[model samples]
Target: MNKIETVKIPRHVAIIMDGNGRWAQSRGLPRAMGHRKGVEAVREAVRVAGDTGVGFLTLFAFSSENWTRPETEVNDLMGLLKAFIRRDLAELHGENVRIRIIGARDNLRGDILPLLIEAEETTKANTGLTLVIAFNYGARDEIARAARKLAEQVAAGVLRPDQIDAVALDAQLDTQGIPDPDLVIRTSGEERLSNFLLWQAAYAELLFVPEYWPDFTRDVFYRALAVYAGRERRYGGIAAAAVTG
Candidate 1:
C-alpha cells in the first residue's frame, strides 16, 4: 500500500481496538493473548502517527462498558495497562509523544495513578503527537458530565443557559485541549462505534476493517487513509462547483 504524505493526512485519528477475545480464541490461546498482541498494534500506530506528523491519535483502550467482562479478564487488562505504562513512559517522553489519558481516572488503581501522573508530567513538554488513551471512557458519560457541570454553574448563577454551546461544552469534556477526531477506524470488522467517541466523532469518517486489532498494521492504516482521501466531506454544507475550463 502506498503511504499518504503528511500534507493529506487527517489531523486527528481515533481507533476502536476490538476483536481481541475472538482473535485469541481463534489461535487456541487465552483471550489475554489477543489483548497482549493488540498492544503491539498500538505501538505501531503511535510510531506511525509520530512519523506522519499527525496531530492526535486517540486509542479506545478501554470503555465504561468493558467492565462487564469477566473479573479475571478485567484484572488482567488492568495489569497489562499498568505494565504498558511502566514500560513505555520513558520511551514516549524521549520520542516527544505527549501522552494524555482521558476518561474517568477515579476507577484506576491506586498504584497506577502515580505512574499516570509521571507519564503525563514527563511527556507534558513534548510536542510530537498528542496520544490519548481512553481508559474508562464512554462518550455518553462524557457528555452527561459536561451537561451536569453546565447545569451546576447555571444554578450557581455563574453562567446563563444560552451561554452553553459546542465550544463551552467542549471545554468541559475530557478532550478539552485535543481537536475532535477527523477520522475513526475500527478493526475486527466491527461496524459500530460501540459508544467509543459519540460526541467527539459527530462527523468523523469511520472505516471498519475485518482484521482484528492484533493484526492491524501500518499497511492497514495506509489503506484507511486512502479511503478517507476519496471521501467527500460536505459537513452539512453545500460545495461550490468547479469553474468550466
Candidate 2:
C-alpha cells in the first residue's frame, strides 16, 4: 500500500507493546527471547513512524506495574533497554530523532539513570520525529503527580482551587507540552487500555490488532493508519461542513 499517499496518518501514535511472554510461550521459547524479539519490532516501528510522517511516536516501554513481574524478567527487560540505547543512540541522533522520556525518575536504579539521561540529552536538540519512551510510567501515577503539583500551588496561596481547570491540570502533567495521541494501538488483540494514557487519550481512537508485539510489522503499522483514516472523529460535535456551510 502507498501509505503516505492513501492513508491519513495521525500526528501522534502510542503503542502498548503487549504479549511478549505469550508470544514466546506460543513458540515454545523463553520469555526473555520474546522480549529480545520485541526490541527488533521497536526499531521497525520507529522507522515506520518516521517514514509515515508521524510527528510523535510514544512507546509504552515499561509501565510502573511492570515492576511487579519476576525479578529475572524485569532485569532482562532493563538490559534490553540499555542495549537498545547503547546500540541505536548514535544512529537515531544522526537521523534527527529526538528522544523524550516521561515517568517518575527519582526511584530509578543508579546504573539505569545515567543511560536514560544520556539518551534524552544526546537527542534533545534533534528536530525530527519525537520518540517518547514511556518507561516506568502509569497513567494513574502521572495524574497523581500532576495533582500534587496543583495542590502545592494552592497551598502556597498562589492559586485558587476554583481556578484549577483542565488546562491548568494539563500543564502539570508529565506530557505537559506533548500533543495527545491521535491513535492508540494494542497488539495481541487486547481491547483494554491497561493503565496507559488514561488522560491523554480522552478523545483518541483505539485500534486493537491480533498480532503479538513481536509480529507487529511495518505493514501492520500502515494497516492501522489506514483504519484510522476511515474514522469520522466528530469530537462531540456535528458535521463541520453542515455547521459551517
Candidate 3:
C-alpha cells in the first residue's frame, strides 16, 4: 500500500505533462502513439487525485507555443482532446468531478469552443474534484490578458491605477476563484516551468521527475506528493526565533 495516506495531501496540484514525443521516439514508434499513451496516464492521474482526496488537479494540456508545431500533429492533438472529452465526460461526471478550463477562447474554432463549453456545462455542479485543463494556455498570455483588462478599466475611469494590485489582477485572471497550486510536477526530467502556471505557482513546491509523461504512473504521483508533504513551506516569513534575531 502507498504511504501517501500517512502524509498531508495537497489541495491543488498542477502538472506539466512533458516528453510524449521523446517517449515515442525512444520506442521507435510514431509520436502520435506516445500521445495516445499519455492520455492513459491522464486517466490514471485523475483517478489517483480523486482517490487521494485532492480537490484540484490542473493539467497543462497544450500551450500557445504549440501552434508552431507541425500542422498534422496539431490536428492529431486536437482530435485526441475532443475524443478524451467525449469519451471521458460521462465517467467524470459520474464520479462527481467538475470540469473547468483555463485559457483563451476568443479565437478558438467554432467546433472546439462548444466542446469545451459542453464539458463545463455538463459538470458544473458536481461538487467534487475540479479538473482544470489548460488548453492553448500560456502563463504570460494569461497575465497579459488580465493586464489589458485592467488597463481598459483604468482608461475608462472605472478604476484608478492605484487600485490595480494583485487582488484586482487576480480577479481578471482565468483562475480567479481557484486556489494556487501547492505543488507543480514536471515529468521527463524537465526542471523548467515551460510557462505552465507562472503567477499561481509563485510559492509552489516543484518536483521534476525523469519519467516521461506517458510513463507517469500512480506511484510517481504518490512519491511526488510524499516529497511535498515533507517540505517546510515558510512562504517568505521565517520561524519566530529567526524573525526575532
> What CA RMSD would candidate 3 show?
1.5
* Model 2 residue 125 CA deviation in Å: 1.2
Q: Write the residue-wise lDDT of candidate 2 on 1-245 in tens digits.
A: 54555558899999999998999999999999999999999999999999999999999999999999999999999999999999999999999999999988889985788999999999999999999999999999999999999999999999999999999999998887899999999999989999899999999999999999999998999888889988978778887787989
**Tens-digit lDDT string for candidate 1 (125-234):** 89889999998899899889999999999999999999999989999999998898989999999799988889888888989999999888898887887788777676
TM per candidate: 0.94, 0.96, 0.96
Query: Rank by lDDT, descending?
Result: 3, 2, 1
Ranking by TM-score: 3, 2, 1
lDDT tens digits by residue: candidate 3, 1-245: 55466448999999999999999999999999999999999999999999899999999999989989999999999999999999999999999999999999998874888999999999999999999999999999999999999999999999999999999999999998999999999999989999888999999999999999999999998888888988878888796668779
Clashes of 2: 0
| Candidate 2: pairs in clash | none
Off by over 4 Å in 1: 1-6, 240-245
Q: Give the TM-score of candidate 1.
A: 0.94
- Worst window of 10 by summed lDDT in candidate 2: 1-10
Candidate 1 or 3, higher lDDT?
A: 3
After superposition, the stretches of candidate 2 with alpha carbons farther than 4 Å from their true spots are 1-3, 240-245
